[model samples]
Target: MGRTDELFFEMIETYQRHAQTARNAKYQETHEMAEILLNMDITAMWCLTQRTPDTRSRLI
Candidate 1:
């Protein structure tokens, strides 16, 4: 194979690997959230929020 073809294949492989990593992370997050809800006995609602770098306020 030519150098250009090799580079193209390498780029595709890298992209697929990165995509799989993202997919796995998302799956893990979902599984953890489900486990938390299942193990909780309270009727309280669960919310996920991210803290901003500049403020104490949380973004849901």
Candidate 2:
């Protein structure tokens, strides 16, 4: 898998592990984030938000 994919999965795993011991409110937020990541169309989302270097410079 690509580096980005590996990092994304690792982030999800971290959140899942945190959810196991996180307090109620923090647990809920982490759990939700993990679920969203699990279900999201990550590549499509990245494509939709990806900016060219020119556009990136304009936002600064």
Candidate 3:
């Protein structure tokens, strides 16, 4: 894959890790994040950092 594809997959992996962490911690938002990562397509996942309020704030 190209660099953009690599980065995109990396982002997905990072988000999946975070979701697992949140689920382990029993945070209320865990389900929401996990759902987004699990159910959304690549385009939607790419926009996730901007679409999710909490994630946007934390990431940016």
> Which candidate has the top score in TM-score?
3
Model 3 lDDT tens row, 1-60: 545455557877866776676577566677676657655545556585555565556545
Model 1: lDDT equals 0.42
Judged by lDDT, which candidate is best?
3
lDDT of predicted model 3: 0.62
What local distance difference test score does each model get?
A: 0.42, 0.50, 0.62
The TM-score of predicted model 3 comes to: 0.45
Which candidate, 1 or 2, has the higher TM-score? 1
Q: By summed lDDT, which 10 consecutive residues of candidate 1 come out lowest?
A: 41-50
Q: What local lDDT does model 3 show for residue 13?
A: 87
Q: Model 2: per-residue lDDT, tens digit, 4-59?
A: 55554665566565454443445567767655654454443344235344433433
C-alpha RMSD of candidate 2 = 10.1
The regions of model 3 sitting more than 4 angstroms off are 26-60
TM-score of model 2 (CA atoms): 0.38
Kindly give the number of clashing pairs for every candidate.
Answer: 0, 0, 0
